[model samples]
Target: MRYKGTKAGAIVVAAVTGSVVLAGCGDGSGSQVEGGGASPSASRSADAQEQGTTEVRAAYEKTAEAESARMTIKMNLAAAGKRITSDGEGVLDLATGDSVMTITAQDKTIEQRVVDQVLYQKVPGQNAPSGKPWIKIDLEKVAGQQGLSNQQIGDPAQTAAYAKAITDKDVTKVGTENVGGVSTTHYKVSVDVSKLPGGEQMSQQLGPTLPMQVWLDDEGRLRRQQIDLTVKAPASASAKPEGSASAQQLKMSTVMQFSDFGTEVNAEAPPADQVADMTDKALQGSRQQS
Candidate 1:
């Protein structure tokens, strides 16, 4: 087993942390479809690609404006005799910086909420004590703990953050399809970890392949996303050999779906009586690390 709250809490952790990323296109396909240059068909393809890029941005742009949505996610990762599969449903609202999500992994449930920046968590063992069922976290301090100056804290502004994450990515149309009861266009992009903001954190945990795809509705709102990657596994936890890549690779795929735009996703803090302070225990490290 990896550790408590590590594999068990992956769904929610990945959901909130990875919700806002994807990418772009190239001439291989776009140009292939164009057939030849200096022709109306090529120009039409260029215009289509341009439109596709605009539509992709518009989808997230609309999301930033809408600020709230009901979403679901499913993820699976397996490598070196270990596998983790999980699913979750939740509300996303960046306007007020609030969110509520319930993730189920390994037959366990983990629920989390963020209201006005503070995080409330209820998980097995770590939190959800008999009387004090919620663990309250100071998000700013949590950011400091992770060495982040401005961490992504699920709010209306987060969509913009997502947009910024893929700003430099290359997006290409893979055709249209039905998604979440809506007509949507599919886009695909492959990227290097060095290109994304804070994406370097992924380098250590992942293999060389990172491909992401998304579906956007006619209204320019994202309805679905699928990310495929591989996780790197270290051979030894305590020591590192001179120069070596991960000893193993875990194939991973995550799918996220969005719906209920402009709906009410009220993410309120738990009552004070049922809460325990986690700044020192969970977010902040022990005295020395602090």
Candidate 2:
């Protein structure tokens, strides 16, 4: 999905930080821990005990497998000490042939639409060229092409990838926090950006390491996430003769909180022709401006 213009740049910056934070926090491996100063037989017994405990923990962490729900997320972003906050509400309907997430937000009386999984700021007095101004993603198509379901968050195969990316030693439990009245475990996880799918380019453009914190509910579903990020200003821009004094570092923080989640087993899908028409109108509007 693409968002154009100045607003797009700002939204992208915030969204990228939010995405990284979520991905980093939710990636961890479930591994057995060995006890110290135990005899060989005793060690075997200890291993078994530890294994059982791990299984119990894992069971508690399993999230519900429902395919749809209404969700509300509030995000607060701070960059160089300046802050911006926004709240979004959406319905995630996955039971339909295609998974659809429709989100809308208002900054006072002005309502903005989020389309195709991308956020867009509605211009005042200007109607959306298309009836719909939100970004849409076809989850069924994505899963069919990728051979995985959205419900595979707890699948062994999927967890293996998260496990490999996250070392057991890298997960540091930071006690517990209350989220929506639920006491959840908080963990700080560090990932080697070099190990991710687009780590190389990301490291070059963003950085080498990404640090995130996650709050996990009793059922192991991620309830909240936060990330510290740094995106460097392009050298050419920073070096401009008329530019402000150069700073070697730029720091930003982003957060996403998930709530009111459940399966929407009977939600209806938006018709294909409607999606096509809206998309075409939006595209034509963009081209006219260009």
Candidate 3:
């Protein structure tokens, strides 16, 4: 299939999130924030909140230090009265921001590799037009038009954005829990979308703040993370004729599980002869149509 205009950019962004954001699914079961006056009891609650924020920040920093790790991602997206789920597994190098992952959805598996901030995908039969096995997308070029940066397209880079969102007033400790058989402490925080990379575009659909949950192991390593996004369709979308199945709202839940920290990951770009530049092709197609 051919990717055109913003639609193509959105698809690429979604694929990039599979590796960058790295989240998991979780029920919104957490300690609720209590109202606080200037009383002594309120002071104690404030202290606890500060401590929780510190702990969560530490885990975020420590996890960013990991050299490499094996990761698996599951995303459930419901839109227009239809649901689609995608699963992916890969190894990510936190230091270099390189990754190799295979994602499967709707009975089709796509091989994706990120090298030096550029993304390469190999789709079965989709490359027949170019007689190539791989399609390449330059994140830098796309970022110029899409309001995304290559620095925010990798696992580690996006992880860094969390640092900007964590604040003592908004972080809450949700007690201890076990993830994947390992004991961990759960923390819930509201992420300010404006602080994220390319967040301005998303804020329109996802709102200003996004609720996120994270589980950290004893050593302050991130074991799991989750985010759920719900978006209401614009009025223009419902402009279809009567009895159409246009979606009123879209919901997307993502879960990312982390394992085997410090693992070795080797990813490289595909051979030039076997790779096609999708950006160039799209430009050429646009010129011809014009």
> Which candidate leads the pack in TM-score?
3
Over 30-106, each residue of candidate 2 has an lDDT whose tens digit, in order, gives 45431222324566655554443343224212432344445554555443344555555445432221222322322
Worst 10 residues of 1 by lDDT: 27-36
Per-model TM values vs. the true structure? 0.68, 0.54, 0.72
Q: What is the lDDT of residue 86 in candidate 3?
A: 78
Q: What is the lDDT for 66 in model 1?
A: 68
Give model 1's TM-score versus the native structure.
0.68
For model 1, residues 12-64, the per-residue Cα lDDT tens digits are: 34334444533222211221221111223566776676566556645555555
Better of 1 and 2 by lDDT: 1
Q: Candidate 1: lDDT over CA atoms? A: 0.57
Q: Give the C-alpha lDDT of model 3.
A: 0.62
Residue 80 lDDT, candidate 3, scale 0-100: 43
Q: How big is the positional error of residue 277 in model 3, measured in Å on the Cα after superposition?
A: 1.5
The lowest-lDDT stretch of 10 consecutive residues in candidate 2 is 139-148
Ranking by TM-score: 3, 1, 2
The better-scoring model by TM-score among 1 and 3 is 3
lDDT of each: 0.57, 0.42, 0.62
Give the root-mean-square deviation of each candidate in angstroms: 6.9, 8.8, 6.9
CA deviation > 4 Å runs, candidate 2: 1-6, 9-61, 77-83, 93-125, 128-163, 233-252, 263-290
Model 1 RMSD vs true structure: 6.9
